[model samples]
Structure formats: C-alpha cells, structure tokens
Target: MLIPALCFVVMITAVMQTAVVPLMPDIATQLGVSPNAVGWIVTANLLTATVCTPLLGRLADRRGPRRVLLCILGVVLVGSLLCVAWDSLPVLVAGRALQGMSFALFPIGVAVLRSALGPHRLTAALGIMSGTMSVGGGAGMIAAGLLYRDGDDYRRVFWLLVVLAVIATALAWFVVPDSPGSGTSSGADFWGVVGLAVGLSALLLALAQGGTWGWVSAPTIGCVVAGALVLAVWYRHERRFDAPMVTPALLTARAVAPAHLAAFLVGIAMFVQFLAIAMFVQVAPEQAGYGFGASVLETSLLYLLPGQVVGITAAGVSGLLVRKFSADRVLMAACAVGVCGFAFVGFAHDRPWQVIVAVAVLNIFVSVAYGALPAMLVEHVAPHDTGVANGINAIARTFGSSLASALVGMLLATITIAGTDIPSERAFVAAFAIGGVTALIAGFTAAASRA
Candidate 1:
C-alpha cells in the first residue's frame, strides 16, 4: 500500500509540473500574452524546482520523509488553491513556485523507499516509481483536456488538484512509517543550504529568462556570475565540513564524477528531446506541427497516451533486464533507443504511425534512464548521504531542464521563417538532428561510465 502511495507522491508532483503543457496556448489566449511569454509558466516552475530540490533533499536527510512529504503536500495543496483564487498570470506564476517545491517528493520518496522497502521489492519498486511520472504526465494531460470540456470546466481541474493534493498530504502523515534518519540531522549547515538555494534559483532564473532579457543583458550576466560565486564558496565550505550538506568528496571521487557527469549529460539530452519532440509532434498546421487538426485537449491526449503506456510496460519488464544484465547496460540501451526515436522524428512525415513508434521508443528509453539512475547512485553512496548525492542527481536533471528550456526556446524563436512566423520544417529538422546527435553522445557516455 505504501509503495503505491509513494509513487502517488511523485506522480502528482509531475502533474503539477506538467499540467500546463496542454494549456500553454490556452493560457496565452486567456491572458492576452504571447505564447513565448507563456512559456515562462513551465520554465518558472522548473527553475524554482531546480534551486530548491537540493535544499529540500538535504532537509529530508535531517528531518525525515514524513515531515518533508507532509510539508510538500501542504505546499502543493495551497498552491492549487492559490491558482484558483488568483487570476493574474504573474500571480499564477507565484502559485507555481509553491507547486515547484512539490518536486521534493521525488528524492524524498526514494529515500523512504530505500529505508523501508525490502531488497526483494527494490528493483521493481524503483522502475514502477519512475513510471508514476509518466502516468502523472499522461493523466494530467488527458484530464486537463477531458476536464476542459469533459462536461466540466478547466476550473474543475484546479479544484480536483486541490482536493487530491490535500488528500495525499493527509494520507502521507498517517500512513508513512516515520522511519530511521528520516528527518533533519544535527548541525544541518543552514548557511550552506540557503546559499545553494539562492544561488541555484538565481542561476536558473538567468538561464530561463535570458532569452527574453537578451543573453548579454547585465541582469543576466550578474545572475550567472552571482550564482557561480555562491556555488564556488559552497564547494569550498563543503570540503572542510564533516557530513557536508552536499557530500563534496563524492563529487570529486575518481569514480563518482564520471558517473555523475554521465547522469548530467543524459539529463540535458533527455529533457531537450522531451520538450522539443512533444511540441514538434503537435506542430500547428501552419508551422508543420502534427497538423492533426486535433483540439488542444485532443492533441494532448495523443501526445501523452503513448508515453504513459510505454512507461508502465517497461516497469513490469524491468526486473527481467536487471536480473540478466547490469543497470548501466539498461541505461545505455535506453539512450540508444531514445536517439533512434529522435532520428525518426526528424524524418516523421505524414505517417501518424511513424510518430507513435518514435514516441513509444523514446518513452521506454526515458523510463529506463531515469528509473535506473538513482539505483546506480545508491549502489555507490553510503545510505545516510544517498539523499544528498541524489540531490546532485536531481540537480543534474534540473540543470538539464534549464538548458533545454533555453535551447529549445531559442531554437524555436530562431527557426521561425522570416516574416511568416511559422517554424520552417527545415529548421525543425535541424533541431531534431541536434537532439538525435546529443542523445547518441549521451548513450556513449552512459555506456562508458564506470558505474
């Protein structure tokens, strides 16, 4: 029961992170903002989540999962409610900040699963846990679309999130076993956490908004430099402390850095592909978007359904692969599949089946890559510091997301045919090719990692 419940926590957070994908154009129409400006809604949330994840993971190390879980749920619940109350786009962005904090559930859930679940369940447990994100992402899109006109208004979607988040919060407090070392540890390096959080937030903001601000803008440059300085000081401080907030020694350890580097590159490659592929698949008629002539909700359903199905199927079969082969091997093969999928996307023309096949293959690879990463990290790191180490992993993913948002956004903005405002298929082709090449390189990196 708790195992499934743990998956629920992450799935729901994923929904919070992604629910707006289907609604981005809708939100822009509603707010009278440009679609590009509307991109900030997702970018803001990811950037905030990027900065706070490490802080929250470290907090969980000291305070325990129960407390961290409850608090995050509380944030999500309030955030949902706030979204309903606030009509302004900026205010909505603020609510998303709270929602972004909800991502702590991912790392915190992994921590609890490690401490409570028996070894027998570990392999199946990890894969299924990752599948929840796929499920949540799919379900969120479908529900957002269906609920938008499924005899209910989009407001119903907000109300539903508020209700479900609250329910999850209540259940987490009661059902989760307040396990050992589940919460905050002593002398928890408060300054270190604050500096990292602030630094990362500024850095992510710079990256996310840099496109709008002009990359050469003083604000952009200042934010980047400030973030670097804070992190520089953080690395120095961590080197001297026992049980440092981030466990710096692991980062520099001969074996660990290579594995971490692989994870970091994989994160960047996957996220760019995720954002780009989905948008390209549904490319608007004028822009070579899928031209499916589908409604937003309808398009979202098509966009989401295949990925969810692939993730679920992979979870069920992961045990076989893990028993017979190494997780590193599984990760490499998955990356290879992702590269193939992206390549197909570059060439996917009118054939809907082609799109489906590529998406399915990509989802499988993504499921395997993310599902296997933390397990690999845990194999090498001490139990007590796994949360922090995984925090680094989470950072890798977030940093990757920041880069993707910027890169994809700039690419889209760049490739729009001059004066037509439509993305040239040729430009999109280039983007797809770049994504495919990046994925192939990441595959090689994963295959070669010492882990």
Candidate 2:
C-alpha cells in the first residue's frame, strides 16, 4: 500500500512536469510572448526545482517525510490552481515555479519508503518510485498531447493537473504513515537555503539564457562567475556550520561521492537521449533529411510511451537484480546498457524504428540505473539522514539534466542548416555521442565504487 501510494504521487508529479511541454507553443502564442521567452516556462520550473530540492530534502530530514510531502503537495496544488485560474505568461511562469516544488517529493518519497518499509521490501519499492519518474513523464506528455491535439485551450491541461494533485494529496495523507521522524527540527538553515538557491539560480539562468544572451556576454559571465563564487562560499560555510544543510562528511565520503557522480553523469545521458529522440522524430523528413515528422501525439505515444513502459518493467527487474547481486554491479550494468542505447542512436538513427529502438533501450537502462543509485546511497548513510542524502543525489541529477538541456539546445541551435533553421543530422549525432560517452564514463565510475 505504501509503495503504490508513493508511486501514484510520483506519477502525478511526473504528469504535471511534462503535461505543459506539448502545450509550450500554444502557450507562447496565446500569452503574447516569443517562443524563446516562453521557453522559460520550463526553465523557471527546472531552476526552482534544482534549488529547492536539496533544501526541502534537509527539511524532510529534520521535520519529517510525511509533513514535507504534504507541504510540497500543497505547493503543487496551489501552483496548478494558479495556472488554471490565470492565463498570463508571468502568472504561468510563477505557477510553474511553484509546481517545481514537486521535484522534492521524489527524494521525500524515497525517505518515506526507507523508513516505512522493511529491508526486504525496500529495494523493489525504490525501483518503482524511481521508475515512475520516467513512466509518469511519458504518460504526462501523452495526456497533454491528446488534450491539446484538437486546438483546445491549454488551460484544460492545468485543470487536469490540479485534479491529479488534489487526489494525490488526499491519497498521501491517508495512505502514507508517519514514521519515527516527524516535526522535530531546531529550525532549518536559513542562510544555507538562501545561498544555495541564489547560487544555483544564477548558474542555471546563465546556462538557460546563454545562447540568447551570447555565451561571452557580461550577463552570462557575471552569472557564471558569481554563481561559482557564491557556491564556493556556501561549501565553506557548510563545512564549518554545526547544523549544515548538507553534511560535509557525507559528501566527501568515498561511498557516497561516487553515487552522486554517477547520478549526474547518467542524468546527462538520460536527458540527452530524451531530447534528441523527441526532436529527431518531430522533424519533417523532407526538411531535416532524416526525420519522421511525427505530431506531438504520435511522437509521445509511438516513440516515448513504449520506452516508458519498458522503463517501468526494467525498474522491477533492476530491483530483483540489486537484491540478488548488488547495487554497484547493477548500476555498472545499467550504465553499460545506456552506452549501447546512445551509441545506437548516434550511429544509426536514420529511421523512426531505429529511434524507437534506441529510446526503448535508453529508458530501460535509465530506470535500472535510477533504481540502483538510491540503494547505493542508502547503504552508506544513516536511516535518519535519508532525506538529505537522497536530496543531494537528486540535486546532482538535476544539475546534469540542466546541463544536458543547455548542451542539446546549444548544439542544435548552432548546427542549423545554411538556408533554414532546421538542425542537421550531425547535431543529433553529436548529442547522442556525448550521451554515449557520458554513460560509458558513468559505467566506469559505478564500477569503481565500493559494492
């Protein structure tokens, strides 16, 4: 009951995350904004999520998972309602920022599972929760695509999200038990939260806007440099602070560092494959020289949906494997699978079927990899610190996802055809190559970690 309830919460979060993706163009058109400006809808969410996740994780650690979960769900509910009630671009972006809080739910759910479930049930539960991220994302995309396919208003999608959030909130309240830790914090580290938020926002803003602002522009350089400096200071502060947002010792430990590193690398590989395949399939074959020109619905249903199903199945398989073997070996194998998937797409994405195959393979290993990662982290950390540790891991993955988005956007934008704005095949190849190589490195990194 606990696992299924948590998975439902994760699924709804995933749905909310991707539901607006298919509606981005319409959102721009209706809101009187440029497509580029509207892109911030997603960027704003990512930035806020990246910053808030770890902070929220620490709060969960001190306060309690159930309390934290309810608070986040409340935020998501408010955000969804805001989007549904208002149609303005700024309002929408603000709502999305609120919605970004949903990312924190994943780590909190992991913590809850760690506390509520027995040791024998823990591995499989984590796998399902992690796998739901991908599955829910694909499901959300499909739902949005279908809802907006007939030129319907985009507000309907937000309305649906609102309903889902409400349901999830109720389910979580009733189904998730209050474990040992609940509302017992001295007080959160206010300074640490502010520093981390400001630093991450600055850096992500620079990355997300760098192409438009010019890579070497003053704003970009200032943000990059300032963000780094602030983060450095934050690191120092955490190292010395008695009640740090993140424990310096846990971060520096050999057992934990490798898992975080591997999470970031796999995160990059995951997003690279996702964005590349989604874009590749949508390009008109005649215009791009090698694309299927699938509609949003077709792309979501035909290309991504299958991979998501495979990912869910693989999550279960990975959980079993982790129990029989070990997380380190399972993670290494998952990375190896990622390498193959990306390599195939990089070298052989000439047909729609090829793209499908590549995406399916990538999703399979991504789920497996995600399943193994938290298990590895939990093995080293104390049960009480589960939320913060997993939250840090989530932050690492978010960082990689942000980088992947920026990297893919830059590569495709710069590698456009001479007379047209369409990206060339080489752009995709480069993206896939980067993903493959990163996965390969992640595999080696995972293997190096203590089993």
In order, candidate lDDTs are 0.72, 0.86
Candidate closest to the true structure, highest lDDT: 2
RMSD of 2: 1.6
- TM for candidate 1 is 0.90
Query: What lDDT tens digits, residue by residue, belong to model 1 across residues 199-243?
Result: 787888788889988999999999999999998888888887675
List runs of model 1 lying over 4 Å from the truth: 28-40, 149-154, 182-188, 284-291
- Runs in model 2 deviating more than 4 A are 182-188
TM per candidate? 0.90, 0.96
Would you give me the overall lDDT of model 1?
Answer: 0.72
Relative to the unseen true structure, what is the C-alpha lDDT of residue 419 in candidate 2, on a scale of 0 to 100?
A: 92
